[model samples]
Target: MSDLPSPHDWVKRSAQSLKVERLEAFFSGHAFDAHKHDTYAIGRTLSGVQRFRYRGVSKNSLPGETMILHPDVEHDGHAGSASGFRYQMLYISPALVQQVLHGKPLPFFKDGVSHDPRLSAATAALLNSMEDELDPLEEDDSLYGLVTTLQAVCGYNQAHGTTHDYAAAALAREYIDDCIEQAITLDDLAKCAGRDRWSLSKDFRAYFGTSPHRYMTMRRLDRVKAAVFAGRTLVDASVEAGFFDQSHMTRHFKKAFGISPSRWCLSLGE
Candidate 1:
């Protein structure tokens, strides 16, 4: 009859892709150190109290409440009560959100937690159990709904007098995808996009919600994940993914997903 988590902490990762990573985890005490992510972290607490520090304030997300952490924001997490907390989270690349909003600014939730039923409904499909595999179309529809619902909840307004070179950004993104396993630079992306380096950098962020460098890095991480999932050793996978070594890849992996590659693999019982 206790709500407390067991002595051991555990995480279960579901099927993931370059665009989204999903996991369900339980923690009894301190869960994460101060860290920032380049992708939006969105989730719902399933039991007990999920506590975190965001934007200089402490917040708690109870069961059925949604927590939204914007990209590149510093935060830390822990359980707010003796009972600990269990939650399901999805890390979504900003580029996917751009696919729906088309170069708009990413939505922000100042409070870091939401009690809105609409947001919960929108995330339901994508937040299903780790054992369930979402159909491709179903996932896409859920993503669209989530993005639009976020905008609605935030009262998003279209900014005027701002323009982005979507063509250039798209060209740069394509080049990154094609050469993800190679060393890339701003100059390289600029040439590929037919624009100057600085301007292209700005445009890339405007359209994709992240810098060209970050985008390339995430793509490389995606490669690393795939190779590892296919049974390759960490060193081999890191090298094949264009990382200098396993340690190099591990740092980025932890920052991006809040868990190391080894832990992530173990979570899936692999």
Candidate 2:
């Protein structure tokens, strides 16, 4: 097990892709303001009670229960008990889930917390401990199993909707990867993919789990994280990563990731 940070500490690990962000944290009380991300916040409470508001309902996650917060929903976090709560979490992108489900609407959990044994076991391996180094194959395999388990548990039957243009959306995603530092507009992506802007926008979100702008921002954020890891100052990194300024980068960084840049650096021993 990785050494726990001091009380009220929040520490995150390193992941090369924005598709995944893993962390182990302890919160004495209110940990974050109401915020939403473009990825599912899936985690397990290890000790004490994890309390949060989801879908306008108050929910409590005790140790051994899995908490699944769907993408793009407002939620808040706090420790439910005086002793505080310790937990491990993985922020998984909807695109990753779409890779498995392939055009299905993202699964929804009516309740934010679950005690299902299968779902619990599936996440146990991935969220086993904060320090476990995941090799490429192991990580991919675990992600595959995890998403399938979620689908089964949530009864996601892949309802039929307007068929999405995955190929076009994929082209836009590739273009974003190629021109990460440049300003990219929906029209730009639409031109590249040979699709209508509004149609492409809906297809992109359905296929990739976020809008074109958000996908670009996350890719840029990935670069920012890499730059910061390479000893570049935050200001330099922000500019190099294509943000307007440090504050611009900081705002999206916290919104996408739940932690500030400096704290992320400190947790990484920078």
Candidate 3:
């Protein structure tokens, strides 16, 4: 219907290694082609009924309900009503979940949807409008809260393992933070933390929710964003931020943030 809002229009926001993909869209009919990705697709229906197929079962996500599609699962989306559906979703990496759970099995929502109030509240914080900007500390708090809520809602109990070396991971994290612009290596991190390379890698993921490389990538991405905000060209920003080229930066930018640098700049309406 001409009067129906087009779902093709959407906006997204994301950062570097944390890679929390946020989207707000309105779909009047069929959406995707039953594809799958390596991130958890969690969302809340904002208006109308969202119908979709998940794990070979037809399901409907009504307003105020949470939709949790696990990583690498096949799914498709469509509107359940003529009125269409508007929603906000966050595509979170399972690695981030592992950070909180310490390498436990990923949580599964059997029905692919839920009415859990804790999930609703937790998702709401991270799934805020695409226009919102979350500072680093605020983002950390929100991410921890969300992952904890998800663990509870999914009925997962974290397994106790050989304790991770927090001191080593923290030292490496600090080193990365200090030398963010340089191309860092696993050996560099291991030496900095006084641990073996593989062990430090595991420890870094356990403590920080991402790999050391991803962490550095995100830090460079932060610099790119700052440069753009301060009125630098994406080209200059990408180079100054330590990317090989604008195209290389663009690829990572889109992959991490779910939007091109040009589109993101336009969203600022400058």
Candidate 4:
């Protein structure tokens, strides 16, 4: 067996309301535990070599390579070099992904890792923004661009396959907007606009760049975030946003924005 180093040999810096964290360490170490979240853990290896396990398989991330960890999977992390590992992780919500996809079906990347240049480039832009102060509009524009870019990279073709006769995804989008507080399903979205679930999912992503489920979560987060900005308690915000609880909302909120919603609110002095 390969002997691992100490777990304490690590350093972490983060902005909490958002789920993203910038880590640089010789992590002569390991993760605290094998844990899973309700968000996509997307990140880049900056220096040395980073190693981890996902979906029951071991993987290595070289510098400039992006590591995509789907939410709710058990995984562990460690360094492959004496220099340790350096990386920034963006915890992405399925909902935010859906925003780009509209009400479309979710696209699956068969590989756990990707070197696709489009995804790489778009990811770099957002990761880079972590270092700067951004206005909501500026951030939204960049985020929207990246989301759409990712859909394209994931093989969402606007001109082909599946939804050949569906109406524009606009109706589904409107239904989601109007029914933000209710429980919705793929079948519901398809029925809302007379499209098949798969076609609706496809058009949602083709038009907005993410899946229906993901879009709903993101929209809910937006409300949760808005409530936070307005000074509602986390519990209140979570319930209002349809999250199971504050902890659930916190996980998703941090995943989407890179910091805990509470801390983020504090940072804003609201």
- Candidate whose lDDT is highest: 1
Identify the runs in model 4 with alpha carbons over 4 angstroms from their true place: 1-26, 157-270
Tell me the tens digit of each residue's lDDT in model 3 across 78-123.
Answer: 8899888888888776656767776555677778999899999898
Q: In candidate 2, what are the lDDT values of residues 76-120, reduced to their tens digit?
A: 888888989888888888778878887676788879899998889
From the highest lDDT down, the ranking of the candidates is: 1, 2, 3, 4
Q: Where's the lowest-lDDT run of ten residues in candidate 4?
A: 1-10
lDDT string, candidate 1, 203-233, tens digits: 8876666788877777788888788779998
TM-score of each: 0.88, 0.87, 0.63, 0.54
Residue 26 alpha-carbon offset, candidate 1, angstroms: 0.7
When 3 and 4 are scored with lDDT, the better candidate is: 3
Clashing pairs in 1: none
Candidate that beats the other on lDDT, 1 or 4, i.e. the better one: 1
TM-score of 4: 0.54
Residue by residue across 44-108, what tens digits does model 4's lDDT show? Answer: 88877787777888788888787777655556677777777777777666556666665664454
